[model samples]
Target: MTIFKRGEKELALIELKNITKCYKIGQIQVNALNGVDLSIENGEFVSIMGPSGSGKSTLLNVIGCLDQPTTGTYKLGDNNVEKVSDWQLSDIRNQFIGFVFQSFHLLPGLTALENVELPLIYRGILGKERKKRAIEALESLDLGDRMHHLPTQLSGGQQQRVAIARAIVGKPSVLLADEPTGALDSKSSVNIMSVFQKLNQEMGITIVQVTHEETIAQYGHKIFRLFDGKIEKIEVLNESLKAIE
Candidate 1:
């Protein structure tokens, strides 16, 4: 697979053109996203910030191809994700997008390595190859020593790292994290942010994360501030806070 270099003339990995998402709850119509236009270039570390009902999660869902927009276009890589069938969207998500949630979401029954191997199992990877990749993924997050531990046995930050390992084990082109650090303490959050920075700067993975904490948002190169279901402003940081190594 070809990795996107920072200065190369690569197309936007995620492009949202006038995207909107509306949900009808009985008699009430809720607009989660309203004509939001956004673009995330390859190898970029971008953060989305907004208050409750601001459409941060909705936008992340649209970008991850997990949910379709009500109108407008969503281009993931070169594919128009909004036009794809549900099955095709699943394929695109499995092959191109990785997701991390606020809740660690690691299975209590499965060991860290086993949990990371789950995605590859769905892809029909063989046992030996799957094990190898899963170990590498865990190691990348400095979780090599805890690969055999269950989620309940690890710390909050360790569990989150395991979740991240699971997300990246598939070699997805983009990682969409929704409130990834919400459950961790300050030190743990910094550790996770450092891992994200290494992945973005060294491995060239495109990272789009939704964070409510301003300190956490400072880790990204750019911040998209959303309000009332639309992007109100974009702030480019002169210098992003370096993740603790």
Candidate 2:
């Protein structure tokens, strides 16, 4: 029941209450998440970090609406995501969540602009408008010159920029990035993180990123440390830094 100011209104972008996710493998039951409660305010940058098998990915899946919790409740804005039907869930995901993967999931045949336009096409936007917006998004990402290039012709960083252009073209409520720099080299990783930081600070986009790298996590305003299926600690680093006298 936490509220934050968003423009003229008070709103919460994401809310999770007593969330639990479990899996049954043959005779053994494994708990992936155990009664986790979290709330992310609008326009906040958050990072979830943990070791392998620490339920970090599970938590991200639940937050992204890609997977459901075994128990507890999740609300994205005012919508009860936990109760939504599969079709309805898909609709919510399409309209609300934008996801970026480590692998840069770009269509092989489509050019950069075309790949960025894919989500708009699925939403039934006309070709002209879609292309306009796609081009604008690419241009914003400094990929205007590369719009006609296929993914195979692009560098790793360029491909990822294309993926980011695709993610943002629809103006989704939350940007969920899982190890966005995992596949990039050190230089490319820095560039990608710089883009993320600029997006958060300048555009005020709500970004929730999951990463194992501490350097990457420092970019977030808040860090949630996960361990053994639970959130062990939550640190408000920006606030802490301000408090240091």
Candidate 3:
């Protein structure tokens, strides 16, 4: 559990080489990714950005082990992602990655605490241990008071925080977020970014998020821009910006 330092050289937590993905839909073939090569070290916060159809989400999925590339070598930690069986991929996702979506994806019927415990429950963690971790996760996000409220009872930012808590309760190695702030207002978006920043800086968690907004993108250490299914360029944000309150 070594955190990657700025000046040190170590194996990346995620590596993608010559990645290409194709989707066939009713006699039409769509090439979503084209030879994208990327690497992300542990404890790094990176953002992916692109125009519509640029494969930003596709790339995130590949890194999260949700989708296999049509062609490529994807090394996540120590596993060859593209060659693993479906069950192994599921296990990998559960053990190594956590996901957050724009919609927050909370179950309406469950309380915030219940929703946060879902991932642990899926892994056969039950009763006291599961509840303990879930409470800690909520407390970590400063949502301890809202733990008993349902999704509909909480504010947008609160619900998202609950979703984030659920993602982190399992203590996954990497967090893949797709437009996590897309559904929030400016203030809430900034708040969510601050939460992510705290997690990356304090908890030594690796985060890769797909975002289209430049202001939001600046929150990350490096912003990868993609076009036509290829990464066009990378912009490194200044270190001082990480001090945003």
Which candidate number has the best lDDT? Answer: 1
Candidate 3: RMSD over Cα atoms? 2.2
lDDT of 3: 0.89
RMSD of 2: 3.7
| Candidate 3 lDDT tens digits, 1-245 | 23234323378878899999999999999999999999887778999999999999999988888899999898876567788899988988887789999999999999999999998988999789999999999999999999999999999999999999999999877888999999999999999999999888777788899999988989888999999999899888897555747
Residue 165: error of model 2 in Å?
Answer: 0.6
Cα miss at 118, model 2 (Å)? 0.7
Clashing pairs in 1: none
Worst 10 residues of 3 by lDDT: 1-10
lDDT values of the candidates? 0.90, 0.86, 0.89
- For model 3, what is the alpha-carbon lDDT of residue 13? 78
lDDT score at residue 108, model 1, on the 0-100 scale: 88
Off by over 4 Å in 3: 1-9
Per residue, candidate 2 scores C-alpha lDDT tens digits across 107-170 of 9999999999999988999999999999999998899999999999999999999999899898
lDDT of 1 at 87: 92
Using lDDT, rank the candidates from best to worst.
1, 3, 2
